[model samples]
Target: MEDIRDRILRPGVNCGQLARAHRAAVLIDGESYFAAFRQAAMKARRQMFILGWDIHSKVELLRGDAAVKAETDGAPITLGPLLNHLAQNNPELEIYILIWNYSMLLSLERDPNLRFNLGWTLHPRVHFHLDDEHPIGASQHQKIVVIDGQIGFCGGLDLSHYRWDSSDHEPDDPRRTTPAGDHYGPYHDIMMIVDGEPAAALAELCTERWQRATRKSIDVHGQNQWDAWPETVQPWFKEVDVAVVRTEPSYKSRQEVREVETLYRDSIRSAQRSIFIENQFFTSTVVCEALEERLREEHGPEVVIILPKEVDGWVGNKFMEFRRVNILKRVLKADVHGRLRLRHPWVGEQPKHGVMIHAKLMVVDDIFLRIGSSNLSNRSMGMDTECDLAIEASSPEQEAGVRRLRNELLAMHLGFPTDEVDNLTKETGSVVRVVDLLSDPERPDSKPRGLGPLEAQEEQFPELVSEAEIVDPKRPLEIDRLLDIFIPDETTQHSWLRAKWLWVVLGVLALVGLAGAWHFTALSDYANREVLAETMAGMARGWTIYPLIVLAYLIGGLVMFPVTVLIGATAILLEPLPAMLTAFAGTQVSAIVLYFAGMKLGRERIQSMAGSRLNRISKHLAKHGMLSVTLIRILPVAPYTIVNIVAGASHIRFVHYVFGTLLGMTPGILAVTIFTDRLLAFLRQPDLSNVLIMIAALVFLVVLTRWLKRRFT
Candidate 1:
């Protein structure tokens, strides 16, 4: 029989040099992890390295008694202030922070002032850098904290708001508020604490990311800095091998690394009796396919997946939730032995929301335990950046530690003591049986805590959700590939050709309708007898006529007069402020009409018109929707209405769409409206000021257009 090491730990599957771990503890959630990190950070004598996707400046590091004491001693408790305090007080200590250059749309959730980035930069010893070097849609998603190269933390919890929660997960904890005093729900995540050579190895990983991002290096650990390990936190495992793995997308020059995916698949495949998992997302097709294969085995492991009942944001709703259901269907079909159990942890009886299980954790048959930031999503598999660490137990002591950690996690979810879980497992000789016992009717409060099974159902509007796959792709995307998905290459007629034909027919009808109005209406007869310019000039002077003309422009878009024509006409006919207001209002109103029409039409019909581009846009929007929409609006990459229609049809949040449109259209609208008004004045009176106004408008338009294009492209 192959050993667990031989089955799981290969060179590429679990990348990086396997370092000997002198001691390791599995910190269950951000509350415990943050507390431990605080103690370690306080004791650090030399250096500290912190890396994350989102690191808020105002996150409270020391909670409970530690926080109370720190406050008593006149020490700052929040992350940014605390780091600054540490750096200032300990002159010899060097601190480095690397955070992902996340979307500006998330400004409300993160540090809007960017004090974490700028405030830390002002400090001499505390160096901070924003990692924006990855692929367009990829994120630097690893969360690692190394203190003085002696103690290391790697896992899902970022030092940010809405992540600090204890394992008890009280349904209505008043203490679960952000620095801004915004209350959040209960959360769950895990971080692995390591000391000795393994800690040094992770410290090296942090430095590598920092150096890649900043193009500069600092000596973090000159000699072994093992003296800084906190005495308070107990180690679960001693003298075990640690495997550091990562998922890096190929960008510019860096080669893609998918060690996390490979390790997960191999671990699932090698499970002898039972497999347990906890993650923020369960949407990786590759990972799901692997589980399916394992489930098909006659004597395969019983898999238990603990996940969040609902994804967090609109993008998450757009991409992950539906994909999860589809993936869940595939897994359920393969579970012939009735072995797979998918659940979400709940707090009280019929809780309002399930505890958000953000822990990227896995365990197999008490032989292997893996933890890190790699979620079971396509992004984590190969697209976005990730890091995962694992240990394959080789001795009795290591096995005991792995088993203990697994039970601890399961116990927390089941709302039972670890000893109860241990006894139940021993009595039944099966982890699956233990789960059955905790959830049985005979047990007191047998409602299984918050660990409830997720029921499979037919997802509503599967195509709308499926379109998100383009944005939340499993692999790197090329421009050509994205275009192909959105706009088909084949000229050959297909079923969708009928939809295209209808659009062409509609265009012809629209032109005919416009012509009929001009030829048959009273305006056409009036135009034949009077000069058009003089009539428009007289009409512009009428107080009610100008508003009526603006109304006509807004309504004209429904029948298809090019928006540019309406904009130019509005600019030429009216004075600057009225013209600007008219154009902006008309354009926005027209966009809203198309947007609503698209949303009403549904995704399948829209796909027939635009093909996979819908998916590509969805994928990009998932990660950076607000920015993408803003850029598209500013640049006029496609027709203005078409952009709105696509966004609405694809179910991009209404708020995001409106915000992008409002901000993006400002410069162009002001430039064109002002330019046309000044040009008309120059023609009538030929004043020097009017000429200067036109020149300034031209410069603004050119500069704004070029800047926006460069920013995105």
Candidate 2:
């Protein structure tokens, strides 16, 4: 039978294209990649294109250089300033940098004023752009650096804060501090450097992405006369072919591409001796199933995987963690011959904080080596845009290079010399056996690169980790198809009412919430309507009371108190007519106060609080006249006061704001006042007609809310 590698691997199917590299080297860890990139950038004569998921302006690319930092006028040798210096020094060189336009959720986590500073610096040769042209939930995740179109670097390392770390991966390394001087855990990632034709190929990829994002054409000239390859960085493979694979979501009418996933699946299936993978995430069901299938065969090659011990984000912790655990369990179940091993890299005496493993890398025996920004996650497979570079060993020399790189990576993580790892592997004829022999099970707490198997406690949550399978599906699914999972099985009379069950269920929940509020809150016990009305009317005559009410609303907004509760209180305290007018005036005042307060806090703070959803919603409201504001006010998609602040921060017009708030609040104020004012009467008389009327009003409110949501959203 033909080898699976020969049969499954093909251009445009499992990869984008094949290109030759006169010289290629693997830069292990961010420290090495950053240094190499810095040297190359400094030597650029024409153009330098830098692109990443994130690019921090002040991220220290060259750390531990007290003399060099002082020599540079103490201006901090960060990525932004360094690039500016390089561009300014080389007047003919054009530097274009592209970073993903991250959501507001990460606004505070990154530099708050990076965009403004980058633009205000006013360097004609330096250009910076934010790529926000991807699909809703997707990100541009390629990390590439092309210098003078002659030398290029591509892999998982991003020129950002806390990404720089030595190969030792000391958990408590003092050099692992951020630009803000806050200490962080040691990080690990890899990058590949290629010179010659392959570098120009990567440069072409960067140009296409740049044009797509900024609509600006970046001229790709012929072979560069200048050589930008760093003299210090030695080549690992000479005269080899590198395959460039990509994963692009279907957006802007472009066809979807899953070349990265195809390459990964094919590579796993083709492993003859061993399959090794190290990734930050392992939540792709398809990849897991592929591995599980291979493990089912009794004579299958041994598989070893290294992952971070804990998930980093909300979705990662709850959703991805679940999927990871579930998939590992399935793989273990299929591993009847015990050929699979999954562990995380540890560096403590007692297994304290594990080093963060961010490298997306795979090695299949000695035939294939891959390293890039494509994680073994669902997003990398088909949602997020990704790029990976791979090399298939076609000759003895190339195969030796691949094998040596894999062994070097293992030695770094295992705290063993490269030769020792090789000797152990040769002695045992198994990669897993070598790892087991080096790992100290009896003294698992020992430091440096002790391996810690995933804890036995993960078996308890079989079903929880599987929830991430929804968002991390391995293939591209259309919006309609993805949404259909939420639809009910039973047919409905009206095609437009296909989601009627959702509305019905929401209505029931709302009613239950109302009942709970009435029962568990002060509303039921404090039924002194006459006393409250008299007291409120007596105070209403004084001008001081109005300011106090407005002040109270302002303070309420600051504390994030629910506006509905305040409105309900207004209905209970005053008569219907006065309460209606008071509600209108009070809400407008509150909105005005909060809007300006939000303005004072600035858009960054407001956005951080509102998150990306509120920012997106505020943009919609700003684009419309009164309808968007009115819809938002009525539907309660977000907290009322926060929306007001978001509107203020987002620069919605005051006229539109006041009118929309008035129109949107009309129904709610009237309904609540009618219910509150008539509550005591209904209770005393037990009038069925009044009760039926209140029920009808509630139903109408629900129906209107649903209609507005469908129309606007």
Question: Best lDDT goes to which candidate?
Answer: 1
Candidate 2 all-Cα RMSD: 10.3
Question: Over 4 Å off in model 1, which ranges?
Answer: 1-5, 70-74, 104-122, 222-226, 350-352, 445-448, 480-713
lDDT of 1 by residue, 386-473 (tens): 9878998988989999999889888888888899888888788787777766866476666536466787656753644424554467
The sequence of per-residue lDDT tens digits that candidate 2 reaches over residues 370-451 is: 9999999988988888999999988999988888987887788778888988888878899898778778755454335666
Candidate topping TM-score = 2
In angstroms, the error of model 1 at 83 is 0.8
Scored by lDDT, model 2 comes in at 0.72
Which pairs, if any, clash in model 2? 322-465, 323-465, 349-445
